[model samples]
Target chain A: MRYKVRELTDMQNSALKEIINIGVGNAATSLSKMIKHQISIDIPELRVEIIEKVPEAAGGADKVVSGVIMHVDGDINGYIMMLLSEDSAATICKAINEEEDTDIHTPMNQSMLEEIGHILAGSYISSLAEFLTLDVKISPPMQTFDMLGAIMDQILIEMSQNVECTLFFDTVFVLEGKQMEGILLTLFDPMGMDKLLGRIDEMT
Target chain B: MIIVGMADSAVAKKPEKLTTLGLGSCIGISLYDNRNCIGGMVHIMLPSVENARAKDNRAKFADTGIPDLVDSMVKQGAAKHHLTAKIAGGARMFSFSSNSNLNIGERNLAATKEVLDKLRIKTIADDTGDTYGRTIILDTETGQLTVKSAQKGEKRY
Candidate 1:
């Protein structure tokens, strides 16, 4: 049976929220160290739904570009994606890399995506592993810079099934006193849900 | 001198050559023959082996794209034994956590080397690794390879 947001028990809801909170905290710490600047991280607003429901949840964002995707397999199969606007990405890179100029050229743009991909995947997966006490392997992160349509097309083509669940969140990064926005999307299969719930149940 | 832009691939015959400008972590594999002067260039994006959605875009993956380039070169009278290979690109553009799984650039270089070795084609030269991008050019007429790196300038690799 497909699981919806409402189907989640109270315990499950709190567990998921805690997992995201920890992940965002780790990400903020890493960003602070890398950029050598004081940064603030906000708990991502979380929504759980089937993959097909992503568009409706995405809301009125005119475009979705500069994304990184990491696929996980073993016990469960799913994907973790971080999406950002090109402008926001440039600003973040300038802040982190200490670049005087925040121009987003092809080469610099690619490098920024690589760095962000590493941090987001690292923190998210580590938090999940710690919460579940299960070691999960992540594939190399792939960065895709394209329009919303192209991004959605690629996701649909790769996933091939609309039955999967998606966890979406928006992370606001305050770096050097400048606020930058980033979005994280985590996909989980039915099997993944079972594994996640099982682990949470053990915690209680 | 033929230039292959980003997301572009090209082939050359005797007296002609192909090149790709500015390769950052992206790999450039040159297939050439000293005798027939038939060659091609592929600037691949990722190092994916699985036939995923990118399989449709042959230029995106090394596993599928490299073979396709080889087959096309052979059809143009470039024999396996007579062919020489040269590769460049694959740089660590940024610093990240150690736990991040596959290194796409490293994987691209490794997959390219392995595929060429299996085909019994010796890699005449290569300039890979480091944290900078490169501009690569191949001369089908003379089998000369030139690599221009971002920080180090241009040189023959």
Candidate 2:
């Protein structure tokens, strides 16, 4: 029988959160090193929720932001995403380029954001793989600036087709002293989630 | 303003506006009847629900959602013949070399128009297909739709 996301036990739930925290923490480390700014991450949240509620749950659907998305392949299948507020995107851009301007729309700046996202995602997914002992690889990142819902609605649509519930794992992080924040989000399909839970079971 | 959410639909009459936010690849179809000043909006994720496992959510697909919205508008006193449609938000937000999921937006946009055509609803305005996101609001009184984006500014049609 397929294990539903909501069927996760309390122990499983906390374990899931811990796994996500490790992934986000790894990303935070990579980001802090690249930007040379202190990164502070909040406790990661892992929830199994209906697809329609995801946009509202993450943030308002219309909130404008910068987004970086990548598809995960190999042993696990899912999408890894980053959503940055305008302030966070600009602040990160400014730090990386050592420029006074804080714009992320410039071609060079956009690419920088993509690379940063790639590095962060690489670090994040590897930790997940290592902990679960699963082989995984990620596609090149696609970066865009748009409304939060617009940036991720397609992924939700694709996920919604197969299952009524989705795993929404997110962590909010800030660039210290700048007070600029961003969100790291990962969506694993139900089958992939089942595999993760199976691995977690083996460890226990 | 009433906000229609993904796989959700809403209907209203004069003085009440209908809006849908954060349309990346999903299509937002707005229907209006100027005679009665009735407006409706549906945020559809897929072109059809025929293949879906869950058939209960009619508002989640273009084939079922648009007709359902129209029927509800008629039930709310909007004349069917006078109904005109305005649509926005079918953006290819991200692209990958081999990923078909990213192309859902284009497919959604096409299916929406096809449904409207079959229903004989005149499509008065269309703002779709790009690499950005859009938020749209439909004014029931004027049947005007305002499309807003992060960097694209705003436009009404």
Best prediction by DockQ: 2
Query: What tens digits encode model 1's per-residue C-alpha lDDT throughout A1-204?
Result: 334544778888878888878877887787677667776677777776544345335432125356676777766676777777777778777766678876655776677677777776777777788778777767777665543322432343234232434566667767667776666777766667678777787788
Weakest 10 consecutive residues, lDDT, candidate 2 chain A?
Answer: A172-181
What is the C-alpha DockQ of each candidate?
0.02, 0.85
Count clashing pairs, candidate 2.
1
Error of 2 at B88 (Å): 1.2
lDDT of 1 by residue, B35-71 (tens): 8888889876666648443245576567777787888
lDDT of 2: 0.87
> On residues B1-157, what C-alpha lDDT tens digit does candidate 2 reach at each position?
8989999999999999999999989999999999999999999999999888777899999999999999999999999999999998888877776567758988898899999999999999999998888999999989899999988899989
Give the top-scoring candidate (lDDT): 2
Docking class of 2: high
